[model samples]
Target: MDNIRHRHITSFQSGYDPVLEPIVFDEKRKTKKPFRISSIKLKNTLAPALATIRNFYNKYYNIIHPLSFTFLSFLTRFYLISLSDVVMWDESHFGKFASHYLNRVFYFDVHPPLGKMMVALAGLLAGYDGSFNFESGTRYPEDLNYTFMRMFMASFGVLMVPLAYFTSIELGFSKHAVILVTLMVLFDTAYLCISRFILLDAMLLFFTFMTIFCMTKFHNQKCDPFSANWWRWLIMTGISIGCVSSVKWIGLFTTALVGLYTIEDLWNKLGDLSIPKIDYLKHWVARIICLIVLPILIYIGCFAIHFAILTHSGPGDSQMSSLFQAGLIGNDFAENPLELAYGSRITLKNTGFGGGLLHSHVEEYPGGSGQQQVTCYHHEDINNDWIVLKPREIEIYDNETDVDVEFVNNGDTIRLLHLGTERNLHSHEVPAPLTRAHWEVSCYGNDTNGDEKDYWVIEAVDDIYKKTNRIRSLSTSIRFRHKVLGCYLRAANIGLPDWGFRQVEVTCDKRNNPKDIFTHWNIERHWNSRLPPGGKANYKSKFLRDFWNLNVAMYNANNALVADPDGFDILTSKPRQWPILEVGLRMCNWASDLIKFYLLGNPAVWWSGTVSLIMFILTLFCYLVRRQRQYNDFSPVQWTYFLYVGRICLIGWLLHYLPFYIMGRVTYLHHYFPALYFSILMAGFLMDHFTASCSLKTKNIIFSIHYALIITIFWYFKDTAYGVYSPNIELRGKKWLNTWDIVD
Candidate 1:
C-alpha cells in the first residue's frame, strides 16, 4: 500500500489521472485535540471588534489623547488646591490687589492689571467679600471660598497640558513625541505648584502657551493664506499676544517670538515671484491690522476696564499723577489750592517714576552725619508735610499765617520746614546711606535756627503743558538746588536701612544734570489761608497720558527690585542657575506643621530638557557641517521640517530666557517656567528625530520606559507641589541635588 500511494503521488505530479490508486494512513498518527482555535477562526472572530475600534479611533482620536491629558492635568493641579489656609508667597500681594478690585479701590502694581482683575473675578464668583487683607502668613477666614478661587486659577494650568499636546501636534511632532510633551508638562512640579494658587504666573503661563499655540497654528496655514481658518488663527494669535502682554510685561518675549516668525514669513513671501504685488501688500495690511493694531487695542481696552472698575481712591493714588488722582471718587486733590505760596503747608511728591512724597522724621540717621532722617514716603503721613517759608525766615510759620501772599517763582531761594519735626530741609557733603555719590539729605536745626545750607533754590522745570516759571500746585514740576552744595535734591527709589524706616532715601545728587526726573518734585497737597481752592478744571487727566505715565512708573519700579547687595535673598535664583535647576524657591514658610510648597521642577523632566537643548545645538552644528561637506542626511521636506521646528523651539527658549540675564531686577525660578515650555517642546522634537526610523514595537517600548521614569520622578517629587503636610525623613532623601532646599 505504501508503494502504491507513492507511485500514485508521482503519477499525479506528472499530470496523470490517478483516481484508481489507493491511499494508506499511518497507524502511529496522534489523535486530534478536542478543543483548539485555528488561525483562520481567530482572525474571523476579531475582525468586527477590531474594525469597530479602529473606526471609533479614526473618528475621535484628535480629542481622545488631548482629553486624557486634560483630565490628568486637572487631577494634578486641582488636588489639594486649597490645602493651605494661610496666604502663600505672591498671594499676599496679588490677593490684596484682587481685593482692591472687589472693593473698587484704585491700586498700583508692577505688573499689568488684567491678571489681578481675573483673580478678583474669581474671588467674586467664589463669594468672597474683599474684606480680608491677605497679609503674608495670615490665616484665611473660614468663610472665604479660597478653594474655588484656586480651582479657577488651576483651570489655566490644567488646560496647559492639552495646549502642549495640541501645540506639539501643530509643530508636526509624532504621536509618541506628543505623548512625551503632554506627560512632561503634566508632571512638572513647578508648573503644578504655581497654578494651584492665587497668582499671576498661571495666567501669564496660560496666555504664553496660547500665544505659541496660536502662532504654530497660524504657521500651518501659510499654504492657504487668507483662508477662513488662516484668518481665524491670525486673529487668535493677535488676541493671545494681547492677553499675554496684558498679564505681564514678560509676555512681550513670546510676542517677540511671534514677531520674528512673522518677519521671516513675510521676508520669504517677499522673495516669491509667484505672489503678486497687490496680494503681498494685502498680507502686510492684514498683519498690521491683526498683529499690531488689534493687540494694541486689546491692551488699551484692558486698562480701560481697569480704570472703569477702580473708581475710588486707594493706596495707589500716589503712584499716579495728581490729576489722575483728582479724578478718583474719594480724593481731596481737587480741593487743594491751585497756586503755591509762602507759609503753605504742602507735601512735595517726587516726580520720578515710582517716587514717593518728600518725608522726614524725628529719627536721626544711624549713619551719614546723624541728622534727622529725610526720606520719601509712599503713604500719607504728618511727617510728609512741610511748611514753605522765606529764605530768611527765622521763625516757624503758624498754621494760619498772616504773611502776605507771595507766589513761588523759578530760581527763588526758599526753606522747607518739616511740619512734624520743625526742622529745615538741609543737605551737606556727606554720602547718602544708599547712594554714595549723593549728599545726605536730612532735617537739620529748628525752624528758626537753619543756616545757609538750609536754603533750597526752587527752579521751575518743564510742565506737562508747557514751560512755566511761576510754580503752581499739582501742575508744576520743580527742582530744589542746594544753595551751598549745589546738589539737586533727588529720590532715586533707593531704600534706606531699618533704622531709616525702610522708606526711600532722599539724597541731594551731586551731579548737576538738569534732565534728571528723580530730582523733580510737585506739590500734591497745598494748604494756604490766602490762595483759592483749585477746582477740577486744570486737574483733568487724559487716559492715554495716565496710561503712559503709569506704565513708565511700573517699569522704573520693577527695575528697582534689584537684590540688595548687602543682604542675601534665599528665595532668589540667578538666571544662569534656572535652566540647570541649581536652586529651588521656598514658596512659603517651611515650618514642620505648616503645609509647604517648594518650587522645584521634576529632575527627570528638567535635566532631560537641559540635556536636550545642548544636544539640539550640537546636532544642528553637525548637520550644517555635514551638509557643507556635500552630505545629504535629509530630503528637502525633511530638512525643512527639521529646521523649522528646531528654530521655533530653540529661538523661543532663548528669547524668553536670555532677557532675564540682562534684566536688572531680581529673578526667581518661576521666571524660567515660560522658557522651560520651549525647552520641553525641543525635547519632544529631539525624541521624534531619534525615533523616526524605529519600528512601532520599539517606539512603544521606548515611550513606555520614558513614561515610567517621568511618573516615578514626579511621584517622588509630588509632595513639593501638592503640599508637604508634615516633615518626613523620606522627604529629605528625595533631595537628589544638594542645591535643592526641599526640607528644613
Candidate 2:
C-alpha cells in the first residue's frame, strides 16, 4: 500500500504523460531505480570554445615564462652591441677623470666623486696587474681591462628585470599584470643600453628608484611618523637622493619632488587630527623633523664624506681642502682645519687653479662683411646668446671631439672656411678633388643675410710667363657662403688685358648682398701697373694654412674653445660652475635620452624593469607594514596594482626621453612623459574599480581578454626580439678579463 502511495506521489511529481510513469520499488531485491532515463548534462556547455581559449593561453604563457624571461632579458642586452663599441663622447671624459683619480692627481670635476669613484673602484678591482716601470721604460700594467667595468653596469641593467617583476607582484597587481609589466621592462632597449655602458646615469637611476620605493613604503606603513625606524628610512632615502644629486644636479629636481610629496602627505594627516590646533601643529612639527630635517641631514652627511676625501691635501688623506678654500665654504664640525687652510684653488677651468692651466679664450675672426669693425667683446659678462660659448654652448661641446669640415675650390685663388654641424660626417658628402691653381675656403654663417659670417681663405697663385709680344694679368676672388646645412666657398679668376696691370679683391660681406658697402676686402690683390716684355709672376697657398683654418672653424663651430678675458673669475660666476653645468647638462641628456627610447626605440620595455622593481619593493613594504592599521582603510590589492601600473608608466616615460637627452639639453618631451604615464595608470586603476562592480561573467570575460592580449603581445614581441641586436661580444671578453684581474 505504501509503495503504491509512493508511486502515485512520484507519478504526480513527474511531468508529461509519457514521462509520468512512476518507478516500482524492488523491495524483495532491496533496490530501487528510476522508471525513465535521460542523458546527463555536460559540465561545460562551451567546451570547444573553452578548450580553444585554454590552448591559446597555455601557448602564450609558455612562451613568456621561465626560460622566456631569461631569453628576453639577454636578448635585450645583446641588442646594445654598438653602445658598448662606440664609447659615447661623454664616457671618454669620465674615463679621463677616473684615470686622474687612479693616478692620484689633483683633479676637480664638477660632479661629485660617487660616480667616478665607482668607476675608479671598478678599475681598481679589474685593472691590469702590471705596474709602471719608469726605469725599464715599460708600463707594468700591460693590459687595460675595461670589460669588467662594463659588465658591472650590465649586471645592474639585467637585475632591473627581476626587480621590476617582484615590484609588480608586491604592488598587488594580478598575476597577469605582473607578468605584463615585467616583460615590458625586460625588453626595454634604452635600459639595456644604459646598463651596458660605464656611466653614472644607471647608478643615478638605481638610487632614484630606491629613494622612491623607500618613501612610498614609509607612507604606506602608517607607523608612528616620529619613530626612529621611520627616521632611519627617511635618512636612507635622503642619502640615496643626495647620492643621485651628487652624481648630477638634475637629481635635485627629483629630490625636491619627493620632499614636497612627503610634506603634503604629512599636512593631510595633520589636517585630519581632531586634537587642538597647537597640539596638532606640534605633531606636525615632529613629523617634519623626522621626514624633512633627517633627510637634509643625511644629504649633507653624504656630501661631507666627498668633501673630506676629495679636499684632503696630505699623503694618505683624501680631504678636498683645495675645493673648500676655492669657495666651498661652510664645513661640518668634523672638517679638518689644516686641510682647509692649505686648500687648493678651485677654478672653473680646472680644479687645480695654479699657473699653466688652460683657461678658455676666444679668438676673433673677421665677421660677416669681412671688414665690419665689429668688436667681439670677449667679455666675461656677455650673455649666452652673444657670448657664443655660454653654458648652453659648454653643454653642446662637453662631449664632442670630432666635427665636420667643408672645402670648395674656385678656379683661381683657393679660400678655405670651417663649418660646424652636429651631423656626423660619415653620412654627408665627401671632399671633392682639387687640381691646378684651385683654391678652397670654409666659413661659418650666423644668418641667411651673412651678417655674422667668419671666413677663412686659402689661395693658390699660378706662375705665368709671357712671350715677346703679349702681356696678361691674372687674379682670383674667393667667396664663402654659410648655410644651415653647411658653409660653401667658391673661388673664381678674372684675366687682365695684355700690357695692363690687374687688381684682385677678396671681400667678406656681412649682408648677403654682394653689393653691400659693409662688404670689405679681407685679402686684397694688387699687380704692378705695367707688365714687362718677358716678366713672370708666381703665388701659392700651402696645405698647412688651409688645414689650420679648417681645424679652427671646426673647433669654434662645435664650441670646443672657451674664452675668458678676466682669467678664471668667470668660472665662479652664478650658474656657471663646471659642476653645476655638468649636472644640468647630464640631466638634460638623461631626460632627452629617455624620451627618444620611449618614442623611436622600444617603448614597451625601455627602462620599465628598473622602475617596476623599485615600485614593487616600495608597494610591498607598504602593504606589509600597513596591513594592521590600514587593513580596511584601502584595499591592499588595489593599491598594489595601482603602484605596479604606475611603475610601468613612470619607467616608460623616462625611457622615451633618453634620445632627446643625448642630443639636446632641453625639450618638451621631458615634461610630457611623466604626466602622460601617470594619467594612464590612474585611469586604468579607475576602470578596474568600475569593472569590479559588474557581473562575475562580465568580469571574467573582461579579465580573460585583457590577459589574452597582454600574453599574446608579449609572446610575439619576445620571440621577435624587437630591440635585441647582436651582443657586444668584444665588450664581454674585455669586461670579463678586467673583472677577473681586479678580483684576482
Candidate 3:
C-alpha cells in the first residue's frame, strides 16, 4: 500500500487547470498517466458507468457515513455502561462532589460546576437518595442507583464521535478521513473507560468537540453575513465554549482558540475590498457580543448557580474564610453570635498558606513536641474554640458585657485559652512536625497561668503597623506574632498521621522570612461590640466580594497543592506521555474479583495517531515548500478553504495541549482527550490528501481494515476498560508496545 504510485498527470481540479498536465508514470501499468482515483480503464477509455459508481459513493456517503459512526460509538460506549457498580478511580472525588450537590451542601471543587451538577442531576433522576458516602473502595449501596449516572456520561461520550464526524467534514476531509476519526474516538478504550464512570471527561469532551464544530460551521457561513443560520452557529459556538469552561479551566484553551479565530476573521473582513470600512463595525460588534460578552455572562451564570445551590456548609468549608462560612446555613456564627472581650470565648482563623481554624486536641503527634497537637480544622468543632485572656490571668470568665468592655488590643501579651482542653495556644523553640525549620505550636496544659513562651501579640495582619490595632470581627485578618519564640504563627498545608486526626499542622514561621502568608489569622466567628450589630443574613450581603475572595483562595490553594508533602496525586501523568498512551491506570478492584476496570487506550489507534501526527507535520512542511507551488492551480479556492479548516484544528490541538506542559497542578491522561480529537482529524486529512491517487477500492479496503483492527483492539483490551472478568493476555498477540500494560 505504501508503494502505490502516483498516476499520470491528466487532471488538475478535474481538468480545469492545464498547468500541471505533466506526464507521470503508473508503476502498475508502466504507462504514463496523471494522478486519479478511478480504475485503470478510466485513464485509457472514459466510461460513464464507472464515473456514476464513483459519484454514487460520494453523493450517498453523507447518509451512510453516520450509520457506521453511530454503530461503533453506540455499541462500545453503551455496551455494559454500568459494568462496574462501584465508584472507581477519580470517581471518588467527582462522585463525592455529586453527593454534596444532591444534599444541597455547599462545597468547592477545582473545576467549575456544570459537569458535576449534571452528574448530581443524573443520580437524582435515577432514584439515588443522596445518602451514600462514595468513599473509595466501598461497595455502592444496595438501594443507590448509579447506572443512570454512568449511562448519561456514556451517552455524552458517544456524541463526541458524531461531533468529530461533523468537525472533520467541516475541515473538508474525505469520507474516508471522516470515518477514520469517528472510529478512532469510538473504539478508543480510554474514552469508553473514562466515559462510563462517574467522571467529568464526558461532558468536557462533548462540549469541546462541539465548540470546534460550531466554530467551523460558523466560519463556513461567512458568505451570508448575519443570516439566521450564520448567527445561530456563531451563538452556538460561544455557548459551547461557555459550557466547556464551566466543566474545567482546560476549557480556556478552547476559549483562546475561538478568540484567535474571531480576531483573524475580523482582520480579514477589515481588509476585504468589497465590504465598506464603515460597515466593518458589524463584524466587530457581532464578534464582541457573541464571543466575548456572551461567554463572560454564561461563565458567571454557571458559578452563580453553583453558589446558589450549595447553601449549607460541607467538607469544602475548611478552604474558605470565616466570614464566607458565616453566609452558609447551619454555621454557628450565622445565628449564635459571640462577642469581643478579654474573657470572651473565640476561634481565630489562620489566613496563611494552610487556611484552617487554629485547633488542638487531646493527643500529640508522634516524635514531635510533647504538648498536645495544635492543628487546623475545617469545621468549627468545640476543640477549635478558644478563650481570650491576659497573660497573667487565671483563665476565669468575665460575662458582664454592660460594663466597660476590656478589648484585647495590640501590644497586649495574651494567650489563646483552649475552651475544650483548658490549654493555651503555645509555641516553643522545638521544630514543627512537617516544616521542621519552623517552631512547634501546641496546646500547653496551662492558659491564663502559662509562662512567657505562651504569650503572643495578636494584631490585624493588614493593620500591624498601626499602634492602635485590635482584633476585629467580620472585617480583619490577623497575625499572631510570638513574643518569646520571635516567630509568627503559620500553618503547614501537610497533615500529620491519624495521631493528629489528619488535620493541618500549625507552626511558627520565622518573622524575618518573607513567605509569611501562613501566619495571617482572622477572627472568623468572633462575637464583638466594636461596631453595629447585624442579622446573620448579612453574610449574604457581601456575595460578590466573597465570590472573588473565594475564587482567589481556591486558585492559590489548588496551585500550591503540589508544594504540600502529601498532596501529590497517585494518578498524575505528565503532558508529554499522554498522546502516546504510555501508561495505564488500574481503576477498580473487587472483594470477590467479579469485575476490574482498567483505564487504557487502544494501542493501534493511539500509536497510529502519534505517528500520523509526525506525518502531518512533514506533509504540512512539504505543502508549504513544495506541493502548494507545484499544484498552485489544483482547485485554488477549495484548497485555500481546506487549509483554513486544517489550520483551525491545529490551533485547537495546541490550545488544549501546550498549556499542560506549563501548568503546575496535577494533570491526568484524560486531560489530553480533547486535544486528541484534533490530532486524529488532522492526520486523517493528510492521509486522504496524500492518498488521493490511490483507487477508491484500495482506500476503502484500507480504512475498513483499519476500522476493524481498532475494533478488534477494543475487543482484546475490552476487559481492561469494560471491567469484565477475563484472563489477562495481549489481544491479537499484537502488543506492539509494552506501554499499553493490557492486563487482559
For each candidate, what TM-score against the reference? 0.88, 0.42, 0.78
lDDT string for model 3 (4-100, tens) is 4443333555655444433456678888665443545555565677788889978998877787777778787878876667668777888888889
**Runs with alpha carbons beyond 4 Å of true place in candidate 2:** 1-89, 106-110, 128-142, 162-172, 223-232, 275-291, 297-303, 307-600, 605-744
Q: Which is the winner by TM-score between candidate 2 and candidate 3?
A: 3
Off by over 4 Å in 3: 1-61, 136-142, 267-281, 336-339, 352-354, 360-375, 379-383, 391-404, 408-415, 418-472, 479-520, 527-538, 560-572, 590-592, 624-643, 729-736
Task: Kindly indicate the candidate among 1 and 2 with the higher lDDT.
Answer: 1
Query: Deviation in angstroms for 527 in model 2?
Result: 51
| Rank order (by lDDT, best first) | 1, 3, 2
RMSD after Cα superposition, model 3: 12.2
lDDT per residue for candidate 2 within 2-36, as digits (tens), equals: 56323443444655453334465677887875554
Clashes of 1: 0
Residue-pair clashes per candidate: 0, 72, 15
RMSD values for the candidates in order, in angstroms, are 8.9, 24.1, 12.2
Taken over the whole model, the C-alpha lDDT of each candidate is 0.88, 0.37, 0.75
In model 1, the worst 10-residue window by lDDT is: 31-40
